[model samples]
Target: MQFIDTHAHLDVEEFAEDLPEVIIRAKEAGVAKIFLPAVDLPSVSTVLQVCRDYPNYTFPMIGLQPEEVKGDYQEVLKKMKKILDASFAQSSPFIAIGEVGLDFYWSREFEQEQLIVFEEMVKWAVEYQLPLMIHCRKAQNELLHILKKYKHDLVGGVFHCFTGNQNEAAEYLKFDNFVLGIGGVLTFKSSHLREDLPACVPLERIVLETDSPYMAPTPHRGKRNESAFVANVLRQLAASYQVSEEIVASITNQNVARIFGISV
Candidate 1:
């Protein structure tokens, strides 16, 4: 059974010690493709290196994470633009613009900056004709508001590690340009995703992710996560939908391919 991890941070330091073994384990567990989301300027080199090392299985998405948006955002954006321009000239090094969105859960100090940065990245995605990988938190309504303004420009992408209500899910569906990312959270007993998601979004509009080194599924809940652990999320989702894991994998794989414009 082939599977795709639509969101993961394999370039993070947590995987630095044993990245080779981790990749082997992921392949052993049936993960055929893994998408890496950039967090900041410092992470770009490492993310690109990972993609180069595992060219057949790993792909990179570049963007400034919302939490990283700050007073020096103008400088950061300049650096990001330079890298993006250089990357585009060499090869289509990135598949999407993401791990980008609004996050008010941490602190609202940089809220305005975050919004500005988010809008700029959205425009970049449009100019490049690339998809977006959104990371929204307490700012869902605000995020949706901005997305609505640029709805016509969006080429669609994954709402990475989605955790929202039925109404929010409905709004995302209306955009017709995204897929809700299901991950380890679905394995939690109290996770509303298991109970509320199936009723709101079609299975085809769902994609699987790990968001690794965080949100590890049960049986590995407190441990550092790896791409291989995505299987646990697939299992839980299959149980929730009352279907075979193969079916869930197949549906999600197709969704990932469609959104990322990747062949799998």
Candidate 2:
């Protein structure tokens, strides 16, 4: 069955030495497409270059990740806006504004800055009519508050690496057009996703991802993640949803197409 890794930081240094082989392995493992999201200003170029090298097999999204938010965020964002505009002018336009959102997992030092930067990214999505690849952590409440403001204007997006409870899942689904990005955490022995996910999110509202260079699935947990390992996530999702692997892939592929306006 074919699948899409809706979110992965393949541009990161972890894959620097053997990226070509990584792509080949991903194809062999049935991952048809990998969406690369920029975590900071520097990564924007790296992500785009990777997509360019792989062509249609890899896609790019521009945004400054919340965890990367710092005191100089405004300057970084301003520079990124220019690059983003230039990207659209190119033949291969970025598919989403992503890997962007609020993260309070490490510390709250940049909480206010994160919120402001996230809102700016949201506006870019609304302006460009592009889907979002959101990365949210302990600040779901704050993220939801900002998102609700542009609820009507948003085209669609993914709640990337979603490990939230049933109530949070339901709240996100209220957006109707968005989808949850289910990744390796689902396979973690200690994760509640195995039980909680099935009860909260329908197969159609979930898409598979690896968050590569991180969140590797069980059996490979603690090791560096890659798109090839996304298949493990797919298998676990099928088990969680009590459906065939093909069914999970098909429905999640459809969800990817619906949100990103791309067909695998």
Best by lDDT: 2
Return the TM-score for candidate 2, rounded to 2 decimals.
0.98
**Candidate 2 lDDT over residue span 128-228, tens digit each:** 89999998989888999999999999999999998989999999999968999999999999999999988878888999999998999998999999999
Instruction: Go through the candidates in order and give each one's C-alpha lDDT.
Output: 0.90, 0.92
Error of 2 at 198 (Å): 1.3
Location of the lowest summed lDDT over 10 successive residues in candidate 2: 84-93
Residue 94 lDDT in model 2? 91
Candidate 2, superposed: residue stretches over 4 Å from native = none
